[model samples]
Target chain A: MRIEEHPILDFKRGREIYFYYNGKKIKAYEGETIAAALYAAGIKTLSKSLRLHRPRGFFCGIGKCSSCLMKVDGIPNVRTCITMVREGMVVEDNDMELPDKEYEGCELRKKAVDVVVVGGGPAGMNAAIEASKYARTLLIDENPRLGGQLIKQTHKFFGSRRQRAGTRGIEIAKELEREVMERGVEVLLNTSVIGYYKRSHHFLAAADKINRIVYEIEAKKIIFATGAQENMLVFEGNDLPGVYGAGGVQTLMNVYGVKPGNVGLIIGAGNVGLILAYQLLQAGVGVACIVEAMPKIGGYFVHAAKIRRCGIPIYTRHSIKRAYGDGKVEGAIIGELDENWNFVEGSEKDIKCDFICLAVGLTPSIRLIAQTGAEISFINEAGGWVALHNEYMETTKEGIYVAGDLANIEEASTAMIEGKIAGLHAAHSIKPIDDFERKIKEYMEELEIFRQGYFGERPKKAKEKILEGYYEKMGERRSS
Target chain B: MKRWEREGVAEIEDIRLPTKEQLQKGVAIIECIQEIPCNPCVDACPFNAISMENINALPIVDFEKCVGCGKCIEVCPGLAIFVVKAKGEKATVMLPYEFIPLPKEGQMVKAINREGKEICEAVVKKVRKGKTPVVTIELPAEYAMEARHIKVKAEE
Candidate 1:
């Protein structure tokens, strides 16, 4: 049960209802989605991972990831995190069989457009708005909403007045979306850009839907803002059905209004893991513990303090040994690690938990960009594979541009600025390159301010290194 | 009226006294302990009684022109506040209580201090329980000097 009154934002929870998990009846709420009820009822481990068969629960409750994916009414792979439950809707777990016919690709329209954006997140939204100044832009998103991970963000953002500091991320997303639509940018929801290819001066986007329409956009430039995918960690019995990505848990609790677990254990100390821990408590679920292999917490101290005051312990230098259960996760074995990162003998601790949330890291979804045959590089600072691009986000391929997490994994604020540059450069192609240079300087300064505090060190350094290498590699090509 | 009387603030009832410092600050921090969500006291004051915007925002009391009318005390759902006056080694404390066998006027009772420790004997000057079952107990000068928060003793 949630606290009656909160010191911060007021929680206007909906009327209560009931649902069933594995044939056992459980109480939920009417307005809230299914995942919320399960968390409130102390149930976690919604399903297992596909390859590892690890128990996965809701981490990001925004439906961006498949951590909260479950079989609803005999439909597998349904994002139960965002799916609202109707009365008597049957929900099951521990199932990972693919559908009879897999979706080969999307039904694409062989039509031309001014520009095509591969994402509709913060970066994609800003890119569309900026590009609309010189071209008719098409913004595409995979989810039903445009916010992406912003929907699960209930905490106040830290930025200048222009970025709406002290305002919630979801509110910022709403404002950004409104600004984009007001600029007459065409926004397409529930549209996933499955592939990207460079042709002449434009990039063809193969999108997925009922009818796979391939949009052959005749753009002077294209911005690939496909974003990043969550990284998975492997362990013994990791293939259990009740583990999940950290982002998946956030989606389950905040969006679908369901609890991710009763006694939940989280791996990783990064912002994603810490934020999800707080969200789990807000959903009225007991966080058994937060496990991190690092010697210290990786997220902001304020975030750690928030959970610590609520009695959730942060176990440093600890790693999950294995998740044990039959078909579903019943418990997890956590052990201490030495300085050499080896498991210490006799230091193993057993925690009775149903769900383990993984927030290990993220890998850029650059498959489409790689398919474009653009010069690609493996940059660890970018967190994964990244297309070689100039400061203007223009790749080796003249008209191909990569923005947002596709180019580098950063916060949404930076991604929005990057999107703007990519969108503008893609519109005018040549003239906006100068404009892109000026915007990058301004954003670099703004980003410095965001990185002033102690918590900003690693990410700020990472961003600097990524930019430094990009400019270094470009040499005079960027000037050209 | 004799020692700690203020200039323009009216003491409509001798029980509820307004403090000199409160009069200077132009605000009164009324301590109401009512569990029910009632806002009559907020409405009863003519000079913007209290802000009732959220039904949850704590009430703000303006003391600049309160006049110590005691109308808010009469209307408060939870009889919590007591107008206090402290001066010259003495003080006046007004309290709200509902109990049978009310203390008689000028009767002496054990003066339990703020820490719930008995300090000295206190003389009750006035006791009023209207037909509404609401009672106001006025304690002596010394009781006001020490008492800030209060709870009544159960009669044996």
Candidate 2:
């Protein structure tokens, strides 16, 4: 099931190692996540669901989802997807395991940075790179690596020089990570930012999973590029072990080189779903069909065209009615959806499949920003609730800025552009730069050009509304 | 125009075809109809044959100065640029390819259209591999402007 070779990406060899899974020895490699090793070994049933006790596998391959949580080396609730494998590590499912013993409290540390950037994805990396030129910027990400989803994306980007068009995303991620490291941005990895305390000007509470050290940092300004979370479609047997997120499947197949499944069914036709379909075929996985509830395909036609030529069937106005299997997905039933978004009567058809993947949409991860008293509003067009920010991406709370999907759900190209804008703005707010206005204008012009395409029109309008709201609020504050 | 395009919901842009006069003059036909934010092709041309009024407008090809150098094909990231010329009964179509196990010179392959429909068999005349790989193939003059992709016969 492991992808020994790929056309685009080269998975170089690593030091061979061994780990114990339920007392059974399994071969692994150093620096590879425990979940990846298991998946490569064809162990998809990582854990079981909480109430129903149904088998659960890797979902959201990032640490955001707890589906891959397992007991590792006497530690409970270890995210196997994010946890690195070591020799002789004892791995067991932690879904039903009780605490064998209570460990001591996590170590604590305090420090201050000129600017602290949250969520080390494209947005955070750009923000850190820009802010570090003016101030001591500190970047923090939950994963051990700096690139968020960019690490998994192997497709070429779609924009001119400003968006790094023509460059594959995986290569771009490596370039960005190298630039961040070389530009002197202080990076803290394997640590998730959990809380923010504005009482002392700036307070960030970060928990490092590797060292079990909790960090408290005070900064003059901060940028939140925390990205978004995937959404699952509702259907019978949706929680089965074989059902996975579009990004989750990408991580399993692309990042770890593990085949997601022999046969699969994708639930959405958006860019995520469309891209996943093609990538699955590249990994030699047979996709039965893509079921989109919308009347038309939601992604770009060029993407759909590629899959069409590859002999994959896409069913528009259709929806997955149910997934049937003993414990994991064995087959699925799909039906057509009416205009009202309901399945039409007697339109159901059975499809022989082993995997059911969801690419419906994503919700912004706004827990920490909300904790900072940032004014967040629900905007469906912007992909659910996002933080309200000014043209400079400054949130309601002064000195705190929002960028990337945290501000609005978009892909890595625009997210990195927004990050550069917010980074420059936050840097100027912290310590004013002489070339601030020129840089902002240049970056904003490039951003405007990037948004001229049809796919970018909606996010462009949402940003206009956000700026208008900021100006209106500013006028009211001045009058008061 | 396609079905989804006629209904005004097409996400992919359609390419504007060149006139008969332009086709014979060795002018480039850029198959990018959308307002994408790309300007590499504009900068790639030394003759200034391609022009963009707006930063994100579809590139305009000047048939007189185009020269059919196919320089833009090397820089286009979307692999959307194609240069075609009709010479008697045969037509030379230069296309961008990125797949692995590339076709060699004098290789006979299936010529695919915009919709992935196989038009006919075409002979590979030249292969330019670099940051972008472009394969120039000679096909029937009737499929001069329609063939945009090459399918390796071995893959089938």
Q: Among all windows of ten consecutive residues in candidate 1 chain A, which has the lowest summed lDDT? A: A1-10
**Segments in model 2 whose C-alpha atoms lie over 4 Å from true places:** A95-106, A468-480, B1-14, B20-27, B67-71, B153-156
lDDT per residue (tens digit) for residues A301-375 in model 1 = 435644653456778889999999986778999999999999999999999997888889888888777887777
lDDT of 1 at A178: 88
Put down candidate 2 lDDT per residue, A1-480, tens digits, no spaces.
788766566777589999999999999888789999998787888888787677888878887778888999887788898888999999987845565432358789998998999988899999999999889999999887889999898777776766777677888899999999999899999888878887768899988877888899999998998998889777888878889989988887888787877999999888788888878876768899888887777776656655665556778889988999987889999998888988889999999998889999988888889988878787777888888888788888888999998898887888998899999998898777998889998888877777877877888888877766666655643210
Task: Please tell me the TM-score of chain B in candidate 2 relative to the true structure's chain B.
Answer: 0.87
Among all windows of 10 consecutive residues in model 2 chain A, the one with the lowest summed lDDT is A471-480
Interface RMSD, candidate 2?
3.9
TM-score, candidate 2, is 0.91
Question: Each model's TM-score, in the order given?
Answer: 0.65, 0.91
* Cα lDDT listed for each candidate: 0.64, 0.82
Q: DockQ (Cα-based) per candidate?
A: 0.02, 0.33
Q: Provide candidate 1's TM-score on chain A.
A: 0.80
